[model samples]
Structures are given as C-alpha cells and as structure tokens.
Target: MTKELLKSTLAELSLAENSTSIIGIKRGIERETLRINNQGRLSSLPHPKKIGSALTHKYITTDFAESLLEFITPATDSAERTLNQLRDIQKYTQARLDNEVLWPMSMPCFIKNQNEIALAQYGSSNVGQMKTLYREGLKNRYGSMMQAIAGVHFNISFPKSFWNRLQVIKGDKTDSQSFISNGYLGLIRNFKRDLWLISYLFGASPALCSSFLEGKESRLPFEKLGKGSLYLPFGTALRLGDLGYTNSAQSALKVTYNSLEEYIIGLKRAISTDSDLYRTIETHSDGSLKQLNSNILQIENEFYSPIRPKRNALAGETPIDALTRDGIEYVEVRALDVNPFSDTGISLQQVYFLDVFLLYCLLNDSPEMDNEEQKISQKNLEQVVNFGRDPSLELIKKGASIPLRKWGEETFEQLALIANWLDTAHGTTHYKTAISELNLCIEDSDKTLSGQYMSALKNSGLDNGCFALELAKQYQVKTQEHQYLELSESDLNNESAHSFVKQKEIENSDEVTFDEFLTAYFK
Candidate 1:
C-alpha cells in the first residue's frame, strides 16, 4: 500500500512541469571540527583571531567550545559547489591556524577533564553573553565532554516552485506556506522513521578515546583497544549513542512532529517549564552567570534531535518564533558524523545520497506517527548504532521483526527510484552513482564507514586518539597544499577584518543590561 502511494507520487513528480522542481533543491552544510595541538590534545587557545571573530564571522564560528570550529557554506543548488565552498572555508581556516590542526574524526581527542574544554566566548555584548551562557547550561546539564564531539549538519530545503508543484499534485488548497510546512513535516516524519539507515551506512565513530567516558557509568559492553580506547565490536556511530550528545531528561518530553503548531508549542513548554533536576544547579556564582536558566531547556537549540525543522531566525527572534512567523524554511540533518576519510568533514557522494534519501522521504507515504511508533523508530536507531554490522541484528517494522539487511535493501530499492528521478532532473548520473555505491554498504556491512574504520583501527594497533591524530595531521597538510576552490585568500582576509568591525558595531549597539536583555528575550 505504501509502495503504491510512493509510486504514484513519483509518477506525478516526473511530469515535465514538475521536473524542474527537483533541480531547484537547495542545500548547505555546517561542518564542525575541534582544533587540537601537535600531541592530539584539545587546543586550549582562544578562537583564532586571524580566522575572524567567532561572534561575527559569516562562514566560520565556534560551537560549544572555543576550540571547536564550525564551517558553514551558503545555500546553493549544487552539492559539488556546496562542498567546494566548505573546502575553501576549511583551507582558509587552516592557513590561519598557527600550529593547531582540525581533528579529523567525530569523536574528540584526548581530554583529561571537562575544564580542558573551554566554553565558546562571543565577546561582552548581551547577546554574546547569552550565547555563552546557553553553552554553560548545556555544560551543566550534559557535560562538556559530550559537547566536544563534532558532527556535520546538512541543511536542505525544497524550492518554492517544488512545493507549489507538490501541492498541486496532491490537490491541496491550503495557503502556500501552510502547504509547504506540512510537506516538510511529512518529510521529517519519514526521515525520523528511517534515520537508522544513515547511522548504519555513514556512521564513522565506531571507537573513541576512553577519556570521553571519564566519571560516567555505561552499560554497553565496550571492548578495550590499546589500553586507551573503548569500542563495540560492531558499533557504527558511538557519537550518536548514549555516550555522545544525548539528553536523557528530554526523553520524557515526548516531543511530536505531527504539525508545526504542536511542535512549536512543545518546544515552548520545554523552554518555559522549570526542571527540578536543573534547579539544584546554581544559575549564578560569585555574581557571574553560570547558566541561562533552570528550565527544561535553556533555549530551543538545547533540545537535541538527529534532525530539525528550521527557519532562519532574525535578530532577537527565537527559533520557534521564526518558525511560528514564517514556518519551516529548511530541514537540518544532524545525524552525520564527521567522515574521517574525507579531507572535508563530508564528501560529495554522501551529499548526493542524502539528496536522494531526503527526496524519498518527501515523496514516500508518511503517516502521522504515534508515540508507540516514535519509540519503535528510536529503538531501531539505537540497535543500529550499537550493532549495525552484526548480521543477527533485526529491526521492528509495524510490530514485525525483520532482518536489518533486508529492511536496508528494501529502502535502497525505493531510494534508487528517487535517485533516478533526481538524475533525470539534473541531466546527470551522479545521483544514481551515489545510490549504487551506497547500496553495496547495505548489502555488505563491512563496506560501511564504521566497518572500515574499525578494521583500520584494529590493523594499526594504535589507540583511537593516535589513529585519528595521524589522519588529522595528514589532512592538515593536504588542506594547506590545496589552493582555495570556491573562495580566495583575499576574500577570506577581508571577511575576517570586516567581522572584527561587525563585532565591535554589535557590541556598541547594545542598549540594555544583561539581565534586562535576558528578561526581554524570555518574554
């Protein structure tokens, strides 16, 4: 029944009028990496001034920790161009680093303590202070070690023309924005249901430095490696597992994605409701702010999810407020680990596959997911993360157990159809090529990123940190040797100087005290 609906949708989309809509898909990336010194310890130095002020830089910024760099690309219609922009940003940043190199893996390098991870500073403006304070809240709630783990975020949106065509095909009469938002919600629901496939295929963090688990107790059976690392024999993305950036408290929130209004309401309730667990943590110490608030979430960004529906928020506008005002402008996929094998955090081939998979989500038949279904999806993802390469692993679909490989094969069969559609739209076979390459990973788990990474680690007989550091150094050299692809050195330098001026302008423009600013923001 579901397959028939998907086939019908595809037939409609393949019409000449709707074909251009597929080509109009827009995408951007936010790739995060931690800076480490020669010895593979997290850099304690402040964000590089030569790169630009973290508060005002358009392409480059810090995430959670001062040493963790986030490189963003402008939204473009071509995945190859987006990747080139990412590479240019990384190359520019690499040129500015005095001696630090970007860590190549999703899991962080050796860190003796949480104090070693410094909160990202954004200068003294009220807004900047609030940004830092939010991280402070995250630190108090989830610990800084988890924040140090880096990931690649893929932000994608269908063009307005595509939504219009889709709405017409479905014979929907809702307002344009309402129809578009509903379409994205359906896409999100399907993405959530099938995200485990992403974990299984692209997940790279099979092993991690043992230091990450310091002062924590875990129930997973992790095997020791070289006296300094721990790993699951068949783990895919440990970074997406419990030891990574997970919030146990939010599990009870049961946030649903059925509608824009309901999603916004749930998030607002989380931000406004006080948390008994967090209340005990001091909000201020020695007259300095320790965190933003003692709420279930300090802000909308604090709520963790593998994927999120997003709209670009205006100045002083919260994420939910932006969504409420304009609806979801894009969807952000945060399930991806930083690909250790790529010079950039992610590869173009991976982007191609994502394009097909997300389009599949949009075109596939997605029904409203109840709480039980949500739980099943979560369970499937967890199972894949922990034992994706294990042939015996099975997943639940509609209360029936199916072998993981069988389910993956079925998903690929549908995705290949979408890939062909995308190929025809773009007049190229890259999408189909991506589908064929990744299909092999589904058939043979040993071809997956986790399998390859684990095999390499075992062969090297080195700890996770040592192996990752070697790759980091190699990538740094390669990045430095390559000329800028989509941007020039002059362009980066001018942007850096302009960012400093912009930071000062923002600092000067502040009119209210910090407390007043917070009150106004919350209000």
Candidate 2:
C-alpha cells in the first residue's frame, strides 16, 4: 500500500495515531478471530484486541517558507530513484522498439469460492488472506517504506464467457457447456457485452515491425513470435492488465509509493470522487444504501492513486510513458492467487518464472499495436481466456492446434532462452533456474501451485475456506522464511533513509493545502 493511500484510509476510517493496525474483517467464523470491540463493528480484516489508545488533540501551523521548502525538496530518495528507474527503463525500451508508447490494460476477474469457511464471513466484500499476503510482501520487499506505497482495492465483474473464450483458445470449443457465462451473478450482470468490449492488445505493432524489418518474417508482430520481449511466451498468462497486483484482478500494482504527496496525487487520478464509473449494488435500505455506497467509493478511491496532474505537451498519450518520464515504473502483476496448498504464497520456482518472464518483456524490443489490430486482439483474447487449457485452442497466430499443455511447454523453452541471455548479461543464473523449474513443473503437475491448490481442496472435501485459510497460513510461514535472506541490513537501511527523508519533509512542509498544491501544479 502507498503512504498517501494509508493516510487517506486511516483518515477516512477515523483511525487515531495510536491505532496500531487496520484489519479487514469479513463475515464467517473467521469473524470470531477478527472481531471488533465497541459496537461489534465489522472490519475488512481481523484486528488484534486492545489497539493502543484513542485520538488526542493535534494541530499544524502552515507558512509560505515551509511550503516553498517542501515544494522544492522531494519527499524521499526512493521517490526520486523509483521515478528515475521507470523513466530510464521506458526511454531505453521505447528507443529500442522505436514505437509509440502504449499503456498496459488491466483486466478484472471475479472468482467464486465454492465453499466459504463461515456463513457470516463467506462472500463478504473483504480481502482476508490476500490482505495479509500484501502486507507481508511489503514488509519483506520494502519494510517500513511499504507504508509509503499507494494503491487501491477494487472489484471487477467479467462474464463466465471470459473463461469460456480461454477454453476455446485452448481448443475445447466442442464443450458446448463450457462456453456458458451464466453462473456468477456478478459477472452475469456487470459484464454484459454492451459494457465491456473485450479485446486483446497484441504483443507487438505490425506496422512498426513492417517498417523496421522488410521480410516475410514480419507478418503482424504477434504472429508466431516465439518468446515475447516481455520474456514469456505469447501464451504465458501475464497479469498485465488492470485486474491489479500487476496481474491479479484487484492488485495495488502501478502504485507510486516513494512519497506521500505523489501517492495522494496518484490516488486522485485513479478514481475521481465525481466519476460515474462507480458501481453500486442496492442491498440495504435506500438511506443506508446511499451512505454505504458513498463510503465504499471513498474507501476505494483512497487506495490506488495517480500521478499529480500537470500540463502535458503530449496530452492524450499513454500515462505509463508519462509517469515513466517523471521517474515512476508501474509494477504490474496480481492475478496470481497464492496456491492454497503450497507451503508458500507462491514457490521459488514461480518467482523465478516471473523474473525471466518480466525480463523478457523488458528486454525484447517488440512493436506496438494499431487501432484496427487492437480490436481484433480483443476477440483473440476472449478465445484464450475462456479456453486456454483446451487441447485445440486456436491461437491468434494461425496454423497452431497445439494442446494448452504443449503450448505451455513451448513457451517455457523460449523463456529459457531469455533466461540464458539474462544470465550472460547480468551474471545471474536466477532466471535460468526459474526456467528449469518451470519445465520440471510441467512434468510434475502436482508440483504446480494451481495443481496443488486444486488437489488439496479436493482432498479436504472441497472446503474453500479451509483451503484459503491454510493457503494464507502457509504463505505467512514461507514469507517469513524467504524474507530473512532477501532483505539485508543494507536494504533495510536504504528503506530507512527513504522513510527518514519523507518524515522530515512532512515535518517541515508548509500549509499549502493539497488542493492548492494541485491547482498550482497543474495550472
């Protein structure tokens, strides 16, 4: 979570300075574990008992000199570094590809937990284990600086047809029953054909490729492209779209967390208070509904943020490019569910897989997409999403009838090539090991996180809650173990430096209100 997001959520929740933590309590027996004091108020997660003290008096004195000093000085070193890294990466990749920048699209997926642990907690608008995992990840990767990261938690509804299409892409079109997108109520209602024009954003731009390489090999950038520049095969499911987590449907990916002010600015851009994009479900009384709706909206907006508004010479271009120029890189990847049966939230194997995959995307100089191709890409995408695992899924790249498993294998091979290249360039065999593990996983499906999850759930009598909760518990354990080695004293110190800089700025900042800052900055 971003610092600005944390502050806003804390403020909105009326949390006091003494409040140690904010838990997301859901309905179910788990509620017993995560109950609230005073009035039995249900939270989004469970919280511990006796959380510090109540609120006390606080004040601030604002002046012009303070404001100028604040304006001129950055909130944190990480803020500058993160933004610079994003800019450098973007510039290098864009120059290498010699194409216009294209913003990544995040797609949302609504998964159904067939068996919830508790009745009250089952199916509530709460992220239980996921929240724990997110917080844990922050502590390990960014530690206290994690508090400065900004992001949001939002839900999305997609038709069952989405999965069905993936099945088709996997060549299971004959399963007439598989294409039905009518099971989940949320998807059936919210993901009607009219609202979402499902489309694929192809890996590369055909026009750019044609311009750059004059040969039969250049038939549309996505065609028969072995491993994409993103390093993964064209078929490897990358949580690139908005579903969040960079890959998950509701991840806090692309958050600017280096500073509180930048995080706030990013939040405002993500979900405007006045936008009609907000979706409201009528369940309680009209008055209650109104209040709940508004509150929930506020809750979401306060999470993910956007860059501070500014006059752009390139007004209607990709925000990714814009943000990159300003020294910020969006870390997209959230779709991955913690394999419930895995000892960890994910595996070292999976982690390595991602490393190679991401490096491939970064290093591979692919083309961008055109308006016409973008439309066709959507159709092609639907085919894969719904029928990805089928034996005869029709890929966008013509003349391919390979089974999904085979496709996965082929993609891994390409990924291995990239991993080898990375090893040569960076002298790090981490990518190579990741690739090798991925190949091994194909041979032993039981070792795959998803496979393990399904098998465990089945063995556990299809208990979804137990499965989920167990997944969460195991993840907690694994993360603690993995963390010890990844975060060294130096890394912790760097994070401390980042935090110290931000804290000092907060202490010295002038009284220029956030609104004022926005008006002046944008104008």
Strongest candidate by lDDT: 1
Candidate 2 Cα RMSD (Å) = 22.8
- Provide the lDDT at 100 for model 1: 88
Deviation from native of the Cα of residue 202 in model 2, angstroms = 20
Per-residue CA lDDT of candidate 2, range 101-215, in tens?
Answer: 1111111111122111111111111222222223333222222221211111111122233334334433555443322211121121211110111111111111011111212
lDDT values for all models: 0.90, 0.29
Residue 437 displacement in candidate 1 (angstroms):
1.1
For each candidate, C-alpha RMSD in Å? 1.1, 22.8
Clashing pairs in 1: none
| Cα-based lDDT at residue 59, candidate 1 | 95
